[model samples]
Target: MNHFFRKPILLITATLFSGSIINAQNVGIGTATPQLGKLEVKGSTGAVSAIFYDQSTGVAIENNHPGIGFNSYYNGGRKAIAPGFGGLLGMDPASGKLHIYTAPASIATAGAPMLLTERMSILANGNVGIGIAAPTAKLDVAGNLKIADGTQGEGKILTSDELGNASWQSGASLVPGASIGYGTWGDCATNGNIGAYQPLTGAAGVNNFGKSVSLSGNYAIVGAPFETVGSNYSQGTASIYRLDGNGWVLMQKLTDATGAAYEHFGSSVAISGQYAHCSYCRRPRRKWRAWFCNHLSIQWQHLAAAKNYANQPCKPGFLWQ
Candidate 1:
């Protein structure tokens, strides 16, 4: 005699859990029809549908394939899963590298391998890379970067402040037919010659105090190529002046470190901003040396120097042009 036993099933329907239904075959919470999978949950509009929590290792979602997939729907219609159709965020366990990928939106095969193009990454050591796999600096980018902080626009360049913060600033503007012209010399009686400036200590004799002069903004630099220094004849000096309420005041005097006779330390001078360049020519040797000075304070600070003879190559410190 053949005998068969039937398994008993228990079905529970609760009204408190938003019409939760439980049966021997499947479980459905917040839904009545759980036909999609063994367990299905449906949430109300604009509310969370599901949540996974773990304190130790965090929540994990897995698929039978390589990378985890995320599905999105619009009006109950599934979007095409393609290479460029979606974005991917992944971490390489072997190399400890994190990568973020992007692609164009196009139709592709679902569950098939995608040609993921890495657009950004973060190394295990905390270096962030953009459009690059490896980053040597804290923030490294392999492509052109645009900073639109409201100050960026056409004809603007990136500039940095004293603290290294960057911002966009307007470039130098040139006016049409703009040129600087000098006035008549030795005419202090008129505006032609603003005022006569001379070194109080070196006014004893002829010092060639005005041999060379350069003006930038409100500052002026005068070169005295024949000024004597303690017994060093014609050692040369450069005097810087600032235009203040009391007229032009002598700010600082610059001279070469080496007080050798006939060095002509300030035969040529050029001033720009808070810096000045003093150059001297050795006509006999057909050579020249130039020194840069920072006059941010009342004192002059030597910044850089370059020396070259007619037969030798110039050093890197100073540029003639």
Candidate 2:
């Protein structure tokens, strides 16, 4: 009687275990039916689908490659999973580095539809690489980089203002044929003659012409300090030119009526409405003279003259009145 009861109990337990396996068929964590995968979890819109956590210790799931991964069907088809169709975030088992991988949209094998290509990688040393497999620096890029600010173009320069704001601006270039011819007063008056009728024979860079320049309205004054007068060298002079409809035209040449060599009479010049000023500084004695310019006749007249007292030791001055 005991043997008969034991056999029935053991047979009943085996039957119940078999039924439990059949009932547990495809397990769905959040859904009634598990889809193509063995385990399926569905999430609400805008919320995380699933989270894997370990309550025993702080360390969660760890694997050589991706411990958990995902896949989707291709072209909205439900028959088969897409080939090379997803992204994976994982850590290297050896180096302990995090890596982001993606698969191309091409079919390779049904078992392994696509090969995982590392798109971005962060090494254990904290170096990152984009489009580069291995990065040796904090940030490394293997492709071209472009910077745009909406108003930048070729032949422009990046400039910064006083407040440290940066922008692009036009670069400097030469104006097309905008040259102004200038020379010594004696050279223009008598066809380059320095003395009684001697032709000017000075070479380029020898005469310090254009030492001073001033502009007023449509008139411009240029100075030549190394001009020769009679038999003296460096008897400075200034020339005034007017801008007509044609261009810059020679107007008049100005010099001290009683200027001597080494005076540098036109070392500095300034021009205003109808007046012009020129300075002559020769150690121990500084002379400043004002001239009244007649634009109509293109003539210059010495208006007033002042001489600095050597003992006064005043500032190197100019006469404007």
Candidate 3:
């Protein structure tokens, strides 16, 4: 995060044989005198440097770097041109990572993937990692999956700053300009333009096709509606897909995990680890949106409701073990 602080004034006396008056902006030590705009500082061979500013805008122009300049994307505002950091050139205070999001939004921007968010790609040796990085830190956040630009036009890509000697994996999607989602082992990119999430070909389809998806560890569960999953509501059919490799593998097509699936039942779902809690709300004269937990089993655990659950009357909130 950007920070600005001012230290309180402290006074000290000089016991020098030769002395001169020291101004608030000037200092005199021994036989040396220094000033902000005049006196120079030489660190090494190229240490002594001067910083010039724009007469009109007062922007920094030392060497070839710009710091804290004016911006006009939204309202022609002002932002900082960050120096190199976090393996690249910027750090996102929100996530404490050195990546592109660290760039001020006035420039093109996108949401970075959180830890445990997986991204795949085709590496240089035709393996996986392409012209990017894989999430290798805690939760493994690789800069391979692209951060999507949600605008009608293309969005800016957050490049993979990992300089390594690893081969590429097949279909590694951690490119800089993809949608963002929370599914590792598969594909999930940040839809940069709109900040929306786009999951790759895996367990996400089951969750995204109808209701929202819940993730636990490496597993994600989605409630497949009869309309989306093309299941027979009359026969009470619900499906759950497991994440395998870089794609989704259908685990099973459930029937009556909640004893009997209601017309529009199975709306909201929450997944954790291997547990998936879902709410089933019948349609038309829907009475209640009862919840059930498909604990990776054929049976379902009915959750308590506030009586007469409507269309997703309440979500299934969970606590970690």
Tens-place lDDT per residue, model 3, 20-83, is 3346445433225555433334321121123333322222212112122221111122222222
Q: Candidate 3, which ten residues in sequence have the lowest lDDT sum?
A: 66-75
Model 1 RMSD, rounded to 1 decimal: 14.5
Candidate 2, residues 1-321: lDDT per residue as tens digits? 455444444444333221111255765665666664666655421222443333211111223343333342122121113343555567777886787766666543333444556788898889999878789999898888565888777765565532346666544344477554345654533432222221222324445667678988556777776787666577777787755433456767787777777777667788876677777754335444333444444467777766654444324444221
Stretches of candidate 1 off by over 4 Å are: 1-85, 106-115, 125-127, 161-163, 172-265, 268-321
lDDT of 2: 0.56
Q: Cα deviation in Å at residue 269, candidate 2? A: 0.3
**lDDT by residue (tens digit), candidate 1, 1-321:** 999999999999865644445565567876787777788766522222442333311112222211232321111222323223544555677777878765445445643443446789899999999988899889999988888977777766676532356766554444577553344444332543222332323345778887788988557888887888788888888888866434457888887766577777777789987789988754455367778888644577999887674565332233222
Estimate the TM-score of every prediction. Answer: 0.39, 0.33, 0.29
| C-alpha local distance difference test of each model | 0.62, 0.56, 0.37
Error of 3 at 45 (Å): 54
Steric overlap count per candidate? 1, 1, 56
Clashing pairs in 1: 84-104
Selected candidate, larger lDDT, 2 vs 3: 2
